[model samples]
Target: MKSVNFKKKLTRLFFVLLGVTLVYQTGRTFFLKQEWQARNCAYEMVKLLFPDAWDRACDQYGLFCFNGSEKPMQKCTGVVESGSIILIHGLDEPGLIFEPLALALHRKGYLVLFFFYPDDQRIDASSRLLFNNLSSLSLAGPVVLVGHSMGGLVARHMLVDPVIDYAGARARTKVPEISDLIMVGTPNHGAFLSRFRLFMEIREQCLLASDHRWHRLSGFIDGTGAAGIDLLPQSEFMRHLNSLPYPGDVHCHMIAGHIFPFPVNMPEQFQMTGNQTLEGLLLSEKNYFLSVLGKAGLLIGDGLVSINSSVPFNVPVTLVKGNHKTMLANCFSGSSRIPPAIPVILDILEL
Candidate 1:
């Protein structure tokens, strides 16, 4: 009789937990959807009221040229002596990722240009836009392309796709001369985090919404966006891109980051001892859950991209000490320190 009663109570408890979970998930989804709708509405309003200002905003999707100054303008202002360097930003970036690097290159007398696009769109679409914009620019001398993350794939598409050639031929404009290409923290194979792109999109939106009056909107809770789908490891886009060969005319280089430092000098016995200790700790029922979490950090290089994924084609690569974002520049903290990859890039540019 006691056993029967216990079974009944357990079943009741399970149902109760399930009901609570379902309610919580449903509420969270509804909140996130509402927040997304509100954000879109606010964006439309600002875009309608301040058309010119909105166009010039870094957050907007467009190509901009900066001549030594931090302020970007439609046209290049000064003399082009050291040639032009176009900086292509990564997925969901608001065009500010290149600030530190752009300024550095500008100081070195390079004509710096920034290409911004709706990162949620298809990669080929963004590539075509970049190619079209470059065709419009009357740049003198060699042009170097520096791409970060997904930007690298965009650059590759521009270089590899026959469609670009067809467009240029039809337009009767010579394709822009690309002398060098530098890919920074690019997931050439694929990114593991891309599987969680919806979560990432929500996080980014929340950060953006935090700046506006709708900041509280994000307190509620996310892109099955085409670009996110393309970024998957086994996606058709990845297969197509990998099949193509990069142009031999342009010199290419990759910069990868290693956030975790593995012990190199430790004795084998010491290593074994450490592993045993870790195993003992992790074998406990309470701490067993942490094992996967710890392994994930080690496997997920620089938090987002694995080292193997960072390099696909056979090219010279420089490994730096920092995570994906930090290797380029500290987006937060005002980027006070010079990033590790900056010096390597400068060396490659011979600036």
Candidate 2:
């Protein structure tokens, strides 16, 4: 036992020293990028050199990102059966943000894996990351995929888009067999906020740059990465993504948040709290995309995504109370998952 402990200590020390050396050598290159980009690159480097540097990295970025595959099965929630459920987070958020939901599902008995992707890159790239990692996991039984916000778009490309088949002419890979797919607060029809041409243009330059995706994204209000950019209403990326039929044999379900009121909806019908309700209507009524009220006054979305954008065609969606940012309390922020959504998600697992 002493020998094993000694070996572990030595290994940790060696990595620490190696990390310092690499940082010393590449610190200049890492420093030159934008603040967020620098932090992102540094985090990736530390992740490779030091196994336990995640907390520090996560703090700087304010996202939940940990792969729980190696955790002891006994400690996992919902251990009733032997199956896996992959959780993908929405735009600019981390996978681990689903802690509340994941734990609840785990108690019900499924091995949950939180999948994280680089927000700075394209949706296709994110999807590729998810598929590639999933291919390596040796598991038995059907796998359920749950994506929140922008994550749902990523999952769609991964399992539903035939064009994005992660196979090349030289080497073909097996498409992941998905049993069911659940999207929470996903913008299936695209969001109105991303429709602004100026913001979209600026985002394009930032995300498509050759050097790094995060280079010029500073100062934009919750500016999205490549996938987020694609979620723009009427954008070409969205058009192509939606052009294809929903692929695979996976069962699909959706969850939409309606805690906030918008301009086009019947004000009295929407459940609203606080003084911001009237403000929401005024702002949304003037929004270029949302300005025109529907025959039934337009109801604004859960702060960010409108109800129309959240609901996907032909997919059954459970409407819950809460705004976009409050749906899943993140690691950095102590906000907890909205209580009402829990049972709905749990019910999906049984389906």
| Best of the candidates, lDDT | 1
Candidate 2: regions farther than 4 A off: 1-81, 166-176, 194-224, 261-299, 330-338
The candidate that wins on TM-score is 1
Q: Local distance difference test, per candidate?
A: 0.67, 0.58
Worst 10 residues of 1 by lDDT: 265-274
- Per-prediction RMSD in angstroms? 10.8, 15.8
Q: How far out, in Å, is residue 151 in model 2? A: 0.2
Estimated TM-score per prediction? 0.67, 0.58
Q: Model 1: runs farther than 4 Å from truth?
A: 1-59, 67-72, 75-82, 166-173, 203-224, 263-298
- Number of backbone clashes in candidate 1: 0
lDDT of 2 by residue, 12-33 (tens): 9999988986675355334323
Candidate 2 Cα deviation (angstroms), residue 247: 3.0
lDDT of 1 by residue, 1-351 (tens): 999999999999999988986686456444544544454455456557666554444244446777665343564433444477888987765456677888888788777888867666567778887877766556667789999988999998888888776235434645557889999989888775764555656656654555341232222211124565566666667888888876777798888777765322212111112124322323333454465554453366577887657755456667777897888788585647899888888998994
